[model samples]
Target chain A: MTPITADATSLFDKLWQARLIKDLGDDRGLIHIDRHLLHDLSSPQAFAGLRQAGRPVRTPALQVAVPDHIVDTMPGRGDATVRGGADMIVALRRNAVENGLRLFDIGDPRQGIVHVVAAEQGIVLPGMTVVCGDSHTCTLGALGCWAFGIGTSEVEHVLATQTLVIRKPSSMRIRVEGRRGAGVTAKDLALGIIRAIGINAAKGGVLEYAGPAVTALSMEERFTLCNMGIEASARSAIIAPDETTFAYVRDHCGSPEWLPVATEAWTMLRSGPQASFDREFHFNCTDLAPQISWGTNPGQTIGIGDAIPPLPEPSAPRERASAERALAYMGLAPGQRLEGLPIAKVFIGSCTNSRISDLAAAARIVRGRHVAPGVRALVVPGSSRVKAEAEHLGLDRIFIDAGFEWRESGCSMCVGMNADRVAAGERCVSTSNRNFEGRQGPGARTHLASPATAAASAIAGHIADCRQVAGR
Target chain B: MKAFRKVTGTGVPLGRSDIDTDAIIPQQWLITTSREGLGKGLFSNWRYRDDAFTPDHGFVLNEPRFARAKILVAGPNYGCGSSREHAVWAHLDFGIEAIIAESFGPIFRDNALRNGLPAITLDGAAVSQVLAQLAALPANRMTVDLERAEVTGPDGTAYRFTMDEERRRALLDGIDDISATLAHAPDIDAFHSADRIRNPYYWVQPPRD
Candidate 1:
């Protein structure tokens, strides 16, 4: 392949400059960006840094700002209920308007989780470099774009220079084969992938999903997989564009440019049957059970009903030390059964698996079942649009009737960013990524699981295998 | 504005492993855009009952000894999950001068430095020892001397550490990196005005192949 190095922008470089790229794939194979995402959390200092540099945003019109992380999840109206959430919305709106960018204010039908709305509105297209201040920006990989999270300074750098300096990442290809097991959704497939390679295995590289199983997934399912790339410690995850992707974009966006731009870029993105990867891992979906992380890290996972791995004889001092420490904090015995380990809460929302599909999965479990006594369960939607769609289908009622709190969208309980949190010493089976200590709150314990597993845990009041309850 | 200056303070011992950011300032607090007074909200859910503003007896922050902690002694892989700087700021706002952990999540540590909070890592055992000492004497004062690259506890036991020399210099001078970047305004203006090329990454490249 001829190296095409044209005078174009890289996504990271554009983030530094805070400018929009005219096109992607300059003859050099580097992709430029059409839009950038700014949020309340990362954009404040970016603006401050720009002020310090005495420059306005390069192309604010191409930028979009929304509040997702800190927004309150309470559904009630009135100033107090919207208190903290409204302030950030006000600040973001002020910032966007001042910078000449578009502001999607709270309550606007267009207002939803940034990634979901971006894909739904066709703002994120195939073959674009989309940088957001949030790491889950990798979700756009489902759209065939190179999107990932960046830092506050990097946000400023992009705003001021519209470019970021970055080294091209090495690549890792994860090929999923065979049809998915009945009742096994994309959440299971993603957890299965993370379990196989370990979270840090894909770090510093771009991971591409291929093979029949991945292609067989819906756009929502693919998004669910790629969206959690950050949780796997990877730089990003991308799925080769296909008819389903084009259809999703076309149907949601309905623009003349969708087909033309998608068709053109999708062709360039596939790993030419002979393309190479720095590393490769393959999985057979047929045998994989609904997966979940029983330990404190996403990598400390096991199949449903499997006991925690006996502390592997530490081949190295670090591994031994880590195992000893993990065992101590989680109050678990090596080789202890993860089943029936009582839980205090169940959280089912995050950029990782909180799409509409995830809701449906949880609803299926919660439909006729009440949460086991004392297990505080909440079902948070990923975006307002997702919430609306689920509500339209009465999915919210299914959960609410089953004693789950149906709340508004945002990264709720995923990172413990807002008021929703698991109490200290409280254990939870969560559908979001990352089970690191205190992820739900100080001294709180997290067990990462799929929506189905989380719902099962809610019913059993512990870590129960979904297949046992959902019945394969 | 005053120049950024190095801050020296006592290290509070938390001694817990895998202390992720979600625990630092749970996600429920991220909704508001206000950066002011987040210290109160930091670890709030754990410290207080859901509807009760008073302290929760079982929570870490509510524990008598750690009520006024200013420095955290943590285990490995601290600050994992979403790159929200709010977690870092909440810690800083709560008067946490430094975090002594086994390691840090890449972006979370960077966010700490940019906001004047230094996340220092040392041997896990060493951190545990510090935690024990702090537990033995809850009010034990430990100083983080950036100039000396050392942290000394109330008992005078010292641990050697390292920080980015540039960031250290900036902190000691009380100036942020962005301010430092701007101090070279004349050079930057000259560079931008020169025959610069735009790279594929959208950054202005120096005029050269």
Candidate 2:
């Protein structure tokens, strides 16, 4: 990265300049990692590597660990509670203890998914460069940070040295203007974007969201939107930190004495007036409806009111074949509407949409209704604080009384590493990000949607829109 | 990490898009601490029949003709969804040395390069030409020469691609990334001490117990 010239810089360029340690040549830089989050599934190997190499974590104070991926979501669960997860959790604990890193153990109130905890505890502040081993680490970009995921090898590099060799991705701005409809949400906005544009539209670039519709979203909604950066093939996504971001950070940012200094610094985290991106995509969310994935991939989506598209014509042979396979695996016919399709299960949790506000949105839809007779519904909060806040506000009671199971926080049903998997061949409407074939479980068909849609689908035993459920 | 120079082997064509890591290796096999012996679980969903491990003859990997395949020619976004290194490990352990696709998930590409597995990108027309040749004659030989930055297809078509200079250099020389960063520790530490004040809230002061 060159020194800032008279040219107005984009938000990504600004963040890149702040975090760059040195330009290691070849368009790659040795960037300093301000905060590093670790989880059970990917960190054990990295810690093991550190042990083998006799290298200590360069900055343990900037690192934190929480076992979320393979942990059981059952109430009163412990480290040894999960069948295949106990050893991973134990390994993370041992590694954290050995490295002098903070570990949110099973009983700790802060124990949760890595992304959610970073937001709720202020582990990731605005304008910093954060990274984790999981792909959804981009979710932290909601706070106007350059956060993205890395693989296990990259994770090991980060542990041994608090720097990474990252290629500076070109900047791309996705501006969502106008007003989204009543029931449409950030989840819907993300799916609609992916559907309108091919997943590779933002490939090899860092995406920055702009425009009034994006700024109007709540912080939690912004988290959900940025979390799907990987789905659109972007390195990461960021929204300029505004009043909503400052208020949220102020609530959890420890050391009130330092918040002013931090906030003042964050104020400069926006793009310049004449900032230009390498590419730009502008969308109007006025007619965007709550999106539902009809096929296996996130891009294979349609609005709730629309029917599944027919197979692509022979002109695009590759597209035609892919659609054929997705249709066969999903057990759906062409031109069939996503609504009124019978679903066997409902999952309303993930790093994507398991926050307190997500639960409240679902609660409003399921307020006075009972789940359908045959549908099994589960709601797992994203973090301990989220679960506690939902209970304090009686959202948990509304879900439980309405026949949805209230579960402890973890990555439940989203990845289904625990015992919360959907049975084989069963169809489920989930709030998680990916809908790949057998992502929920082998032979399980998943329809990715928002929490509100998941809750309403559970009540109706079929795909249903929250707007109609709320009689809006 | 192994050093990559060149490889000549038969190629298998997987004509599918959005082949996510979840499909490459399922979530059930992700609990292990080690990445060894994952070849058995590579595309287990598509390759095996029932819990009894009956090899499905329909899947290309299970077919006898492509048993010695060392290169995978696949559709776009070959390794999308989830930042699982197990996808690269499984492919490497399953006797595949490199993957040539229309495009790949950026994280997967980085992981592959770090592990000495080259993720070569070719345009759609080039990928189709290669896949069509493999479909007609499964035993046709192919070559991926990293030094030359070119891939020789079964039909004698050579497609050139580009890669980041630093990553390509490291993979070719098998350079240890951790040690490389450590060699420059002085630079990192200097920046850390100098910029610590700018991010006052980013540091944690509570002592670790």
**Candidate 2 TM-score versus the reference:** 0.97
In order, candidate lDDTs are 0.70, 0.88
* Stretches of candidate 2 exceeding 4 Å from the true structure: A1-7, B205-209
| Model 1 lDDT per residue over A1-472, tens place | 9986453433222232332222222211112335688776667766865776688785564577777766667786222333455566566777788888766556765666787777775677666678888877888888777777777766776676444434356677888999887567787788778777766666546778888998999999998889777666665788878888888876775545325644664555565654667788898999887776766767677777777777767565555666676666678877888888999999998877788888888888778889999999988887788889999999988898889998877767876756788887788888887776666766678887888889989989888878778532
Q: Each candidate's chain B TM-score?
A: 0.80, 0.95
CA shift of B127, model 1, Å = 13
Task: Identify the candidate with maximal TM-score.
Answer: 2
RMSD of each: 7.4, 2.4
Residue A220 in candidate 2 has what lDDT? Answer: 95
Query: TM-score of every model?
Result: 0.74, 0.97
- The worst-scoring run of ten residues by lDDT in candidate 2 chain A lies at A252-261
Docking quality category of candidate 1 according to DockQ thresholds: incorrect
